[model samples]
Target: MTTAPLASNSSPASVAEMEQSLEQLKVANYYLRVALDQVTDGVVIVESEPSDPKCGPKVLFSNAAAAMLAGADPETGLRGLGLNDLVAGDKDATTLQASLQQAVQNGGCHECECALQSLRTQAPIPCKWRVRAVFNSLRKLLNFTILISPAQPNAPAKADPKPAVEDLDAQSVQLRKENLAALAQGIAHDVNNLLGPVTVRLSALIQQVQEHPALAHELQAVFAGLKRAKQFTSQVVTASKAVPRKHEPTDLSALMRDTVEFAGAGSNVHVCVRQDDNLRLALADPVKLSQVLQNLVMNGIQAMPRGGYMDVEAHNHMVGGTGDGRLKPGPHVLLVVRDRGCGIARENLGRLFRESFTTKADGNGIGLTTCKRFIDEMGGEIRVTSTPNVGTEFRVYLPAAEGSGSTKPLSPADAAPVPLKHGKGKVLIVDDEDDLRKVANMILTRCGYEVVQCDNGQDAVKIYQSLFRTGTPPDVVLMDLTLRGGMNGTETAAEILHLDPEARIVCTSGSVTQEVQMVFLERGFVGVLPKPYEAGELTQTVHRVATMMKRN
Candidate 1:
């Protein structure tokens, strides 16, 4: 018998076309492999050698999903892996082998269920398998394609209805914390607005009562009290909003005095601060450190239901290499707070700084944790010592400012107050609060400047436009962020700038976050003045802006 040569009559041009077609098939196969690798379902092709009984089916090719399901390295994939390696037990392996054989014999797909064992974990995961035989046109077997998928659980045991206890508690704590932060922010805003007018009016009163020493002293005390209240509100905003800290050379002596006074304002605790004459300055964030100090002081006050004395002392010290592992050895400022109150129990001392651990019935257990976090961030350490029913002492060590010597410096309050700036320029004060507008008007008028007032954004726009029409627009405009109607401060500023491109507008708000300040500044505002500001700060900012406008 003679066999006819294949393609004996084929032309050269046909051979070229066939080569191009083969290249296209290769490109198509590459894309198909890429697509399969992207899918989540595991695809594994196993080659069977029925002619050789010793060589069973082995993995011909596998995608990423298959390698992951088998817990094998992606680089090695599942190539050369035997069928038995993928199955968990002998029974499952036998069943899979039978399904493959049936698929080959019938030339149809076969389905079965088995568990795939992970090579790394050696753990069995229940999965469904679909076997399809691949063959050439002549019916010559190529490979068996298997699709592996996670098995669907029986209806009676599908899922666990109850969540884990730890997960539920964590979620509850997080929700409560978020709610508390929101509440604190709201309260701080309202309190700042309420305190704004009082702070301004008290400054004016203090200036007016300078002729009477007795009255002046009393008014000064009240003014100091108001200042402390404002600081407390700032601390509230800082704690709740998680404001980024701005570190500077801080006067620790002054901060301790102010914090102790503010924390013991309404309580029966008497806080006495003793400081070294030559205490060094601390390189720290003033607001955050003040918050920490206030928390400790308040905790001390709360510990003593009855009236008692607490001592706060500050001095400079040098840390050595053998101290606590966390702190770096360097010049340090040590602040010690001691209180004679119902002390903490000995058994609970180790967990004093642990998160969500508290002894008080009404405590949320975040105060000490926050305090420790703040101190740690400032490159400091805070330690506690307590004896049951005796007393408790907290020692805080802060890194000293670079190049700061032992010469005593004045605190912010102890420093001489700058004289209120006197300038002659037309000013417009716009605010929704009646008392705020009135206080600003009085203060500016006393400083020898003509002042105009408006309650809402609409009137503010009208007044500014009218002034501009008359060729005598106000030199500076203080725009309140929150207005009763029409437009807010930002919108009003935009309208004013539309009428006059060179409008000198200042943004004022009780809640002037960093984002808010940046937004207003980008919109061409000249300055930002946070609410509850001192009279000196208000006059200084306004005078500076008005003068700059004239200079231009």
Candidate 2:
């Protein structure tokens, strides 16, 4: 006897188990909703034949926000709608139906925005609609499911979930957007910090070439490598996208001064900033904010490659323009960085904020884009005005403290350089770069110190041991943080300290993460000697280490 397909259902046992997993499914649902709202582009979800109402997408679960775009209230349910019915371009509903059938047959459903619209059209659409296929985990179409999104999906801003779960689906997407925004900001900060020292070293190398024209050809090659490195750094600055971070009340003017000084090294460019000592503070992360300032300052330096003055200014301003015919004057602080150098043309100004858009021959163009992202995350805004040859200025607006005073006095200045004479003492140089090791060796030897060079940590350790055994141990060791093959600078330093508790080992590298630098300090390294060291910086460092050694 032929039996009618008993209305097709997932068996009772499977249904019961799915019912048991509702809690887990609900959590997953929240995340999907979040992605729907927070992503840059759009997302459309269509669910049909849901076995469990709590765990699966229901016709009623379709977000009203989506329908609102189509000029319909989602509170009223939609029924008997097929994928082809939603769009006018579906000339042959058979093709769409066949694809849907295949999706169900495959045990997974899938379709992209293009493939779903490849079918024949039966009617002219009164409404312009963009059709995209919604897919299941296994690349199958959940039969009878239809989701209609505008040309682009616009995720809504998220609201707090704790106070109200009913409003969660409405705002789950917005919170996701915020999270991604913060991530982008962090990435930008890290990338800029990494590039800072490389730029500084390039500057120092150029000065060296100018000082001694005898080594011009050799130094030219080195400069070429450094130039490539700079280009590599610029690319990193380009692709870096970061999410904004949580902002707290901070002294914007003071922070800008500190950031610029630290990154500028006050050597390549003249940095200046001014503000009211008692002006209101801004809510921003000091580290991230510093990274922002550093990137801007770096850009300013590049614009004025011959070296020129750059100014950073910050102050408080009142903002008004609240709806409901009411004016709400709020405390907002403005920070400006201006450089009198080769400026951007009017045409380039409009496209400056776009990703990978740059005017410099070596620029990757991510700096301004990252800056804009960060500013937006902090609940602020950034603007720029530039002339072709005169100069360029960047202005950032940040929310300020409603009721406030000021932070403490200025931070201490950089320590004065200690004077030293070329002395006849044993100096050990450890580095991963062979060229650097040889160059350092030559510099130290010229300065009248007996020098021993090691290209890696293991080699340095072996040489140090051989010397100790031979009773001719070096007086001081310059340890590089990152080394080629075997132990790193820190490990080598630790081994040397094992032999002599008062080993005068100076940790060296052009750039190190602040956290990694701190590790050296905690582990008792005498001092840090950052890389791209000038011939003089190396001499001074050795003299200081020797003096400290004798005293200890």
Candidate 3:
């Protein structure tokens, strides 16, 4: 060792070898950095002084994922931060410190679930932290390595083993539900388009048959059937809608009476309704609540094959002491529907609200489920009690409208219906369905409007622009939302608005979802009209929008 002293300067070959080694090390370091960055788990190295454990640890290094987890710029990294800075609260920091101390003492790895706060977002994120203590050759604590991963919210500490088949089945069921919802949405649109022509043609026929009383009566009956079909289509459309219901102060007593009368019509079942004298209004979506009650009443009517009586009663209830656990403490409108019919079996009671769980031979199995869904969305609860061969009772609890009192019920004269008015103006109808376009044309023409029809959004836009340039822009534009082989209604409406900000465009769609309606309105549409609408609705909507345009 003494004879072989280090050379002050190396030869050319030796220098080249040294440079090659250095380059290889640099290459290895680059690969290591790349590998660390590729890891999904957050990796961080924190240095701590073994002599002063109370001083806590300082972050020495963090990979890209770790930096992201801390809500710091990933490219810059979170190297100069302290361990306590990343914790959510004082308690979290204390817990983390204890875990680090334990790992240091045991010279082993430790793990704990923590709620860490991101510096940028300042939001507490649940994470599973795996910490290992590092020691120097002298057995002195040096630093700690941490691996952090996002923890499943409220997951069990010890996960139980699940069969692979069970997981696959659950996934399959979820996928099937999603697919069915999408299919239902598409079918509802197509059905509404198909029904539009039928409804318009029926209206035309009814007008023609007015002179012949017998034919008029027959056509009226056919029209009633079509109305019922329209109701069914509305339910299908609502099933796929996930938006929040637009709640309003609704008269529960009036709604119950109307539903009972409508559901028990033509059936042998008789419906009786009793309303509380001082009943308060309920905060509910009138249309959805009406649908729920109608479904329940119809189910009650169907339960009784022979002649039977159904009683519907409504009252205001105060829920606080000894109240329902499912609902919060508040005043609620309680509606009870009691039917003397063949009651539900004990086994079927548990699954009455489950989708596709029906005992009827011809039942589509979605009626009760849809009803339950609507009730839930409206922040209400529905419960059923039944006794075999005796009867069944359904109780619905809806939150009462805030600040509502025992006010007098609205009279027929309170809100007079606006009579359908005939208007003289150019109207444009856009729809991919030929039948729908023809139906709209017929309705608009009958309303004394100069009707222009196009089968796609592109043609409609072109026609609108051409008319606009000629200073003969349509008074109203009815744009169908979903289109085939061209720009959709939203896109077309945007273009039309750009060309003429004063354009009065009404969005037409078979999807009667709040989200769809709101989106169109946000995109500058003046109004929204659901498909398969009556001639009166079509006339009224156009007249209303045209009037608005004139006033503006």
Q: Give the candidate order by descending TM-score.
A: 1, 3, 2
Per TM-score, the best of the predicted structures is 1
Cα lDDT for residue 295, model 1? Answer: 92
Q: Compose the digit string of candidate 3's lDDT tens values, residues 1-552.
A: 358765878788988898789667856765777788788888988886533344357787787677656655433367767777788887888888888878877776888888767664434676889999988898887789999886644433356545544554554554345446556766887888888888767766676666898877666666655665676677676655433446889887666655665677799988988888879999988777878888888888888999878898888888996668677788999989899999999999999999889899998789989888888877889999999999999999999999886747745322222234688888999887887688778777877999998887667878999999998999999988776543567778888999999999998877765555675688799899887876767888998888774723
Per-candidate clashes come to 0, 26, 0
Return the candidate ranking by lDDT, descending.
1, 3, 2
Per-candidate local distance difference test: 0.80, 0.59, 0.77
Clashing pairs in 3: none
Better of 2 and 3 by TM-score: 3
Per-residue lDDT for 1-552 in model 2, tens only?
A: 797654457799877787668646755765665554344432344454445533333333333333333222121212223344333344434444454455555544534331222111221212222323445677555434344432322344466434444344433444343333334333433443354344334434555555676674445444444433433333332222221234678877556654665557645678777887777788776555666777888888878878878898887777876621121357777888899889999989989999999877888989889888877767778889998889999988777765765755664321111222476779888875766677777767877899988787767877888887787788888887756444557667788778767667887764433334565777878777754445557777787777664632
In the range 1-552, model 1's lDDT, one tens digit per residue, is 899775877899988898789667856765787788888789998885643333358887888678766665443468777888788988998899899989988876899999888664534777889999989998988889999976665434236634444444544454345446656766887899999998887776677777998887667667766776776677676656555556688888777866776678888888989888878889898877888888998998888999899999888989898876677888889889899999998899999899999999999899999999989989999999998788999999999999986645655446223357888899999899998888888888989889999987767888999999999999999988777544567778889999998889998877665544776788889999888876777888889899885624
Minimal lDDT window, size 10, model 3: 410-419
- Stretches off by above 4 angstroms in model 3 are 1-174, 198-241, 325-327, 344-379, 406-418, 494-503, 521-524, 547-552
How big is the RMSD of model 1? 21.0
Candidate with best lDDT: 1
